[model samples]
Target: MGSNYHINNVNGPAIFGDNGRMEINNGTDAATLLRLADQLVERMRVESPALVPQAQVIQGELAQDGRPADRGRIRAALETIGIGVAAGSGGLALAQEIGRVLGL
Candidate 1:
């Protein structure tokens, strides 16, 4: 059987597979999250160009292939731009998905 883990401030819970592997639901896998991060960066480039650099750093980290990255920095950067990831929101879901992918 698999187990579910609910993280505070995140939109959805994550599942631990029978093989002890973690997976997020609804296609929120690593690649998808990375794509989402890229989209976010692009949107920021237009709407908030000043924050694009921070988003780029996140994109770089995501491109590092499961290497350890700074979740705090990512969160801080988003927060600095008033982007809070509330429950059930796409932002929260994406962040949670990224966290799972990065093994945070």
Candidate 2:
């Protein structure tokens, strides 16, 4: 198996399997994903407050359940997060990985 990489892309989490292919949910059923992520954000408040607004932007991009997600907006949101965090943050790394997959 390859390394596990987590991305909250609008399409949902994507995993790279042993075959070097990305396996993702067909579309998105993540209606409440951002809501759940917000719960985690609460814990992060004392540590990384700057991420709160970035998280909000990401939450805004989440798709309604049973709908096709906006992959482009999701990517853009990642870029926005990249701007708000340190270079070494997971958000930047995730965005880079996603860009590689997207041929950007």
Candidate 3:
């Protein structure tokens, strides 16, 4: 899996994802997503700190998990961000692109 980041507009935080998708919209969900990412990283560190030392392997693992949890989070964040954006903004487009990447 590949990763990409985008901003819905000038006012928002940088949205992150693979294939330009995200699931963070309001401050609450955005915070949750950021928190989730942090938790996942922390969990990975505790469960397999060696991954930290192996960038390539870690990247691959993250990509693999994309199929289940990672991808779902990405989708949710994208929806949230899209809602935050103006109607007909790029958030949905980005989410759609991400879906394409996920082959959903």
Candidate 4:
């Protein structure tokens, strides 16, 4: 069966699904992405210094409140870091969650 989605206290659901695949639209704002990215940086700096630059790119974009995040840049950053961070600590899971929040 396809996974069930539940948003207990959300404003609305933004989901598109068929069969076993589901894609969630981003009801989450840049701020939320920023928070997740921030959390990663704190854990990543010492745990995996090599991935810091890419993580910073994600963090910096989400911190900008004046404009929307550059999805291309953010995706690239995510790709770069996800490769390195995937084998490290629990940070990869967090990064993937952030990507899901961004609807990437």
Worst 10 residues of 1 by lDDT: 9-18
After superposing candidate 4, which stretches have Cα over 4 Å from the reference?
Answer: 1-27, 86-88
Model 3 regions more than 4 Å off: 1-69
User: What's the lDDT for candidate 3?
Assistant: 0.43
Q: Which residue pairs in model 3 clash with each other?
A: 22-77, 22-78, 23-76, 23-77, 23-78, 24-77, 24-81, 25-80
Backbone clash pairs for candidate 4 read none
Q: Residues 2-86, candidate 2, lDDT per residue (tens digit)? A: 8755556534324653356565544433544554445434533543577666555545555345774466666675566567656
TM-score to true structure, per model: 0.53, 0.40, 0.29, 0.70
Highest lDDT: give the candidate number.
4
Return whichever of 1 and 3 wins on TM-score: 1
Global lDDT of model 1: 0.61
Among residues 3 or more apart in sequence or in different chains, the pairs in candidate 2 whose N, CA or C atoms overlap within 3 Å are none
- Model 1 TM-score (2 dp): 0.53
Clashes of each: 0, 0, 8, 0
CA lDDT, every model vs. true structure: 0.61, 0.52, 0.43, 0.74
- Give the Cα error of residue 47 in candidate 2, in Å: 5.2
lDDT of 4: 0.74
Give the candidates in order of lDDT, highest first: 4, 1, 2, 3
Model 2: residues with Cα > 4 Å off, grouped in runs = 1-48, 90-104
